[model samples]
Target chain A: SQTIHQWPATLVQPVGSPLSLECTVEGTSNPNLYWYRQAAGRGLQLLFYSVGIGQISSEVPQNLSASRPQDRQFILSSKKLLLSDSGFYLCAWSVRGPTEAFFGQGTRLTVV
Target chain B: GESVGLHLPTLSVQEGDNSIINCAYSNSASDYFIWYKQESGKGPQFIIDIRSNMDKRQGQRVTVLLNKTVKHLSLQIAATQPGDSAVYFCADSYSGSARQLTFGSGTQLTVLP
Candidate 1:
């Protein structure tokens, strides 16, 4: 069985502060990783997705960025956080082929 | 560009009654669809999925119907229970790129006792 882990389950950051969220998947290799943000009462917005190491496709232009450092490790970062950046961030992983994704517990980020 | 949307923002159903949630997508090239359920403060959970080639698929007390011509999809829940109350979202994916999923706004289902 594969498990996804995300850290700092809850985060409180000051405005303009740097932000870093990490996601790791165990028991799977070369999986597709994605970063999504869901605002209060809104739908999930795809922020970034990576097919492999150093390869990322961003869906919307924003202050956040994502990176795939290792095959099973993905990181979402921001140089400066904005008030609008606060939301529930989710990390998901899927096999290389057509398979349903497995999501992590998710991180609740609040930028004050 | 592909866009998925739900028909309603909220739905209330009595307990034990059947519930149906509807969705529509604008992308004709999409060949796969999935339904997800999310509770408060939790990530979306995969409920069921259907391939575009198939019109309907059934799972444990859940059925997903796909209408390619109308670009619509629906999820049917039998004997709706209180635990089934949550926000449901419909996602679509293209044939070639099956990894990325485009999600809809989601419909909140409330099961009344």
Candidate 2:
């Protein structure tokens, strides 16, 4: 069984402060990783995805960026946080092809 | 451009009754679809999925129906329970970019106990 771990489960950051959220997958190698954000009462918006180490694809242009430092470790970061950056950030993993994805618990980021 | 959308933003259903959530997509090239359930603060859980080749697929108590002609897909939950109260989102993907999913604006499903 594969599992994803994301932390901190909840975060409160001041405006303009730097931010970093980490996600890692276990029991699987070379899996596709993705970052998605969801506003309260809204659906998920794809932010970034990675196919392999050092390869990241941005779905939307915004204040966030993603980096795949390892085969199963992905990190979402921002040099400065904006009020609009506040949302529930989720990390997901999938196999190479079109298949069902698995998600982590998610990180609730609140930029005040 | 690819877009996935839901017919309704919210739905209320009685416990033990069947629940159906509908979704529509704009990309005719879409060959894969999926349904997800999300609790208040948790990540969306995979409920069911169907491919363009197959019109229907079933999971434990969930069913996903895909209609490529209409670019529509639906999720049916049997004997809905209180635990089923959550937001449901349908996603679409084409084979060219199956890893890249476009999600519909979720529908809030409230199960009345």
Candidate 3:
């Protein structure tokens, strides 16, 4: 079975501080990775997605950026965080085609 | 542009009752649809999915219905339980090489015990 893992399940960062969130998937190779954010009581907003290593597509323009360092390792980062950046960040993986995505336990980021 | 939207913002149902959540999409080229459930502070979990070729698909106690003519989709949960309380989101994907999914606002389902 495949499993996705995200670190710093909860994070509190100061405004203008740098941020980094990591996601790794085990038992799968060359999977499509995605980064999503959800505001309080709102639905998910796609931030970025990657088809392969070093290849990322931004769905929305924002302060956040995503990178695929390895086949199953994805990272979301920001040089300087903003108050609006506070939200629940999720990482997901899917097969090549249009398949159902498997998600990891999200990281709740609070930018104060 | 492609987009997915839900008809309701919230739904309240009693335990053991049947629950239905409705969604609508704007892209006629959409060929795949999915329903996801998210608990508080957790990532969205895949519940059920239906392709455009099929009108209905069942999984365990959940069912997904797709209507391409009306660009509408629905999710039905049988014997709703307290554990089923969560936010439900509908997603749509168009037919193309890049299979990107567009998600809806979502409907928060509250199951009262």
What TM-score fits each model?
Answer: 0.97, 0.97, 0.97
Q: All models: lDDT?
A: 0.91, 0.92, 0.91
Candidate 1 has a TM-score of 0.97
Candidate 2, B1-113: lDDT as tens digits: 38799999999999999999999999998888899999888888988888889999999989998888898899999999999999999998887784688889999999998
Q: What's the TM for model 3? A: 0.97
Q: Pick the candidate with the highest DockQ.
A: 2
Worst 10 residues of 1 chain A by lDDT: A96-105
CAPRI band for model 2:
high
Candidate 2 TM-score, C-alpha based: 0.97
Candidate 3, residue B74: lDDT: 97
Clashes of 3: 0
Q: Give the runs in model 1 whose Cα sits over 4 Å from its true position.
A: B96-98
Give fnat of each prediction, in order.
Answer: 0.59, 0.84, 0.66
Clashes per candidate (backbone, < 3 Å)? 0, 0, 0
Q: Report the Cα lDDT for residue A38, model 2.
A: 88
iRMSD for each candidate structure, in the order shown:
1.5, 1.2, 1.1
Scoring each candidate complex against the real one, what DockQ results? 0.70, 0.80, 0.74
